[model samples]
Target chain A: MLRLFKNKFFLLLLITVFIFILMGVTAKQNSKLNWFSNTINVIFSPVEKFFSGIGDKIGSGLSYFGDVKEVKKENAKLKSDIDKLEKDTADLERYKQENDRLREALNLKNQFNQYDSIGGNVIAKDPGNWFDIFTVDAGTKDGVGNNYPVIAGSGLVGRVLNAGFISSKIMTIIDVDSTVSGMLTKTGDQVIIKGDLSLKEQGLCRMDYIPTDEDISVGDSVVTSGIGGYYPKGIFIGKIKEIRQTNNEFTRYAIIEPVVDFKRLEEVFILKNKNVGNTGTDGAGK
Target chain B: MKARNIVFAVSIFIIVVLQTTVLHYIKIFGITPNIMVVVVIGIALLFGNTQGAIAGFILGFCQDITFGKMLGFYALAGLYLGLVVGIVNKRLYRENILVIIFFTFISTIVYELSVYLVHEWGMHLFSPENSNNLDILYAVRNITLPEAIYNSIISVPIYALMIRINDRFENANKSIRKY
Candidate 1:
């Protein structure tokens, strides 16, 4: 039996089968294997700090280039003119649709003013191709907790999947296994946006369970429904890119392109939603 | 043995730190000039295979920690590359800087290619939905020729630097032997 198994063909086949089994078992339970993640992060913090120094230099260099006399003068003049126009427009359209969105956010803030907002920069991205997790500079020290909603100016970034002493890992909305109840901005049709993390283009999230008869159209905007308790209502989620009614389900599904450009994510606000439930499924995939 | 091992460990620590941090800033197409690769190749040329494999695995693990990618990906790749280079070292008599640079370049590709193949294979069997249809062949195309050429160009000076460091160790060893 030993000699029979010693054949190169058999050995290769055995190894191949073993590796396949291993990958399958591992991927299925990868969330449970969060043992080394913190240790790895701790070891790599110095490296991240080093790169941050270089980032500062590059940022300063760009700022210096922008401060050239010709460019600076032009920018200042453009800014003043735009400021004047913005002030006039603000007064004329103070109660119009433009202010409505801001007002809604202000009202939401007033309602949930108990939790302080902590701002942090996205430090490093997950080095692997599959994991859509990124690290932020602030953590427990700044009162950041697991499940805190992270958002950029455009829309939802993700939620704090895990938090460390001085850093936190955000599992972005683009990650696989992520789901958010979203409403069509124009028609108010409710659908759940499912993150297809397997896709290469990160912004792709699918709107599922929409009735086939719903008046959903291409280019319709989607926003959080606020039913999930994780996100505030009317926050932009994405725009419908495609709609398909397959035989597998009664509801038509549409792919959404997220409003946030996750690739270039820098700074973000961590919103402390009081209604977020105690879902034990924090950072380690639990 | 203790002092020499410490020196090797220190050198590897410095190389891995520099590779992920400073060199990352100058990255072109995610291919940073890997000084750790040059160091392992240099050691294989000088001290042979067993030591080479050990060094490669250790440094590769350090790299995995810094990169924060799927764990053990680079470690396994480096181990295989080190063994192959060690086997080739037995039949080769060339040790010029340019020749070493070429060896480093080829080994760097080997290391990267091995990791890429592993990742592709992992994704295919684990998550078919995420798998790219072309597999390794597609990954090879994405790497492009220019990135490899850039790695080769940077490998020359970095390889020279490692050789100098090795020479200093050898000189110190010889003086200690006399004492």
Candidate 2:
């Protein structure tokens, strides 16, 4: 035993087994970070946040010079868009008043009105290409918890995987491990929005298990079905770009162009329900 | 020895911070070079198997804690990578640029393959869906191959830096021993 203990190869083998054991222990979905990892994350969060800010500044500064010509064209386009939007705003105001009246008469709660949202800056991204996980500069101290839905300016970003003291890890919907129950905005048909290994490279996701007889078509919008409880209902997911038939012939999957520009994403909002435990049941429960 | 260890720890921390923050902007075709692989191989070649393995473990642990769903996947991969590189390079010339580049390219592929195998096939830890749904050919063609090429290209400068740091420490240690 002593001879084996002194063997370098033996020691390496032992360490490998130990790490495998550790992996098994922590691989569960509900596993919490050990105190050591939690402490390290707390210490590193501020440094990461600082460096991320500097990186963003440098990126924007470099892009500003290259964007001069494009900006001029965009400015004109935006002016025209603004003129069109001004006319639509009046019609939207009347609709908003009617919507408010109908909601009060029906005694129905607003889809997202019951939640309080906190903004977070993305501090870092996963260094590898396999996963679409990123860290946000908000945590338990800021009331951000696990499974909270995250969104960018345009649409749903993902959900929190783990929350530490000063930071949290978010697994974006484009990750292969991620799956969200989604619904078609037009046909009210249910589909599963999943992160595909191949499709994620194009900054897109796959919507599978589409209903066969539905009037779903390209350019139709998909939103959260709110079935799995990780996300609230009616949050915009993406627009279907292409529909591909599977080998089974009965099933089909559509490519989704997500609204969130994940490549340039800098800030996000985490939705926290004002009344705790009201968002839905825990994911494991479902 | 203690001072050298401290330097290694600090450098590893700095590399990780830069990797996650600034490295995102420099990605080519959505693939970021795995500098951690290059650093581990360099440390193993410059130092010994023990030092290489320790460095790899530390770097992997940091990544696992920050970015991984599970704790030990990267840590285990890194440890084996460092140990294998350090042991295999014992009889080879370490200073040759071509040899370093070759090793970097090979090690990056090995590292990524092991990660994919474990995450996608072996454990099925992260992906809740069936593993068959994942296309391995796509992963190799798009992710592993490009990453290996990128890491090899960047290894020249990084290996040079590692050599300089190793020389400084060696000289400091020699003077201390004389004293």
Candidate 3:
């Protein structure tokens, strides 16, 4: 035992194991915890700015020609009202969809005005493959709390995992630990959605305990059932990505593609309401 | 020694910020090379296990802190990688650039694999429903291995610089002894 101390290899391993054990024990409690994660975000802000500059340069270069072409194209298209009307119809259709989504979201938002909502940009991604989470610019000072739902234009992102003064970390919908109660929007069949962080960029979530007899087609949409205290009902979750139905299995499962585009995720709204019920209007409405 | 140590710490801090926010742009096939991991391995080879482990722990800790992960995951992974590399280095001649390159190549894989395993197992325990559906091999190929390889290549120049620093320190010590 004395000689083992001399081996730095063994010593390092021992220390790591001890730390792991200690972390496991206190994982539940909110100790001093680590502020270094938040500190790193602040330190890395300049780096993000540098990249954003490069992105702007590249974007401007590519769009310069398109900008010139677009002016002429806009004039030509404006000359023909019939063609212009068709284009306007398509645009109007898209706008209607957008309007409806926002309308639903606004209705949901009105239910929880008691709690403040913080708007923040996603500053960084989950560092490595070990976790499927994200770091955002909102924190405790922003009124964001643990398990606060984050939403984009589409629907759900995840919930607040760790929050600071100016920023908070979100465990994305792709993370394995996240479980959102959702239902088939067309059929009203309740199911539990789990995140596949492994396939995060694909925006995949898994649905379990789905009845075999249910009419769950490939394109059937999923939405939060509001059974879970965190996410309010009627928020669009995703379309069914894939289905794996085994003969022996009693309950079928399907992979869902989240409505939010994870790759282009930037600014998101951090919802402060954990209790979706106590809020004024029922989210599931006519 | 103190000045050199401080330089290592400062350089690593700068590199990590660049690695996460800047180098993320250099992604090829969904894996952005991990510059910090390679740097840790390079430093470990030059300074031996104690310094190597220290560097690894700090760098990995920095990654975890910045990325908002479960604390100490990267730190422990890095510490072990550095120790293993440092210990094996005693029996091998790492003076050649090819040797350093090879070291980086192998160590990166080791580092990534360790992290991935911990992640899967941890997720399995924390959320079993999410764990059963993952394509582990695809995840590694798309996101893990390529980044490791890219970082390994990047570490070649960095390891050469580390060797140069070591040489300068040894030369200074020799001059002092002669005086």
Best by lDDT: 2
Write one digit per residue (lDDT tens) for candidate 2, span B21-95: 888788998899888888999988877777788888999999988898888888888888998899999837899
Instruction: Judge candidate 1 against the unseen true structure and give its global Cα lDDT, from 0 to 1.
Output: 0.64
How well is each residue in A24-55 modelled by candidate 2, as lDDT tens digits? Answer: 77766456545556678987788889999999
Model 3: runs farther than 4 Å from truth? A1-10, A29-31, A35-115, A246-251, A274-286, B126-130, B133-136, B164-179
Each model's DockQ score: 0.17, 0.77, 0.43
Ranked by TM-score from best down, the candidates are 2, 3, 1
Candidate whose TM-score is highest: 2
lDDT per residue (tens digit) for residues A1-286 in model 1:
7786378446545644663443344343233443454555665565665676677578678788767777868888999999898998887686666556754654433333544567988666654333467777787677777667788885888777666556777878777546677887666677888766334344587778786668888998887876765566666788988887877757567889888987667798887644333322232243
| Weakest lDDT window of 10 consecutive positions for candidate 1 chain A | A277-286
For candidate 2, give the docking quality class from DockQ: medium
Please give, for residues B1-179, the per-residue lDDT of candidate 3 as tens digits.
Answer: 78777777678867776665556455565566777778878877777877778888888877766663467777888887887888888536777777788888888877787777777687689646556555668666776677667877888777777778778888987898998
RMSD of each: 6.5, 3.0, 5.2
Q: Give residue A284's error in model 1 in angstroms.
A: 6.5
Q: What are the candidates' interface root-mean-square deviations? A: 5.8, 1.2, 3.1
At residue A8, candidate 3 shows an lDDT of 56
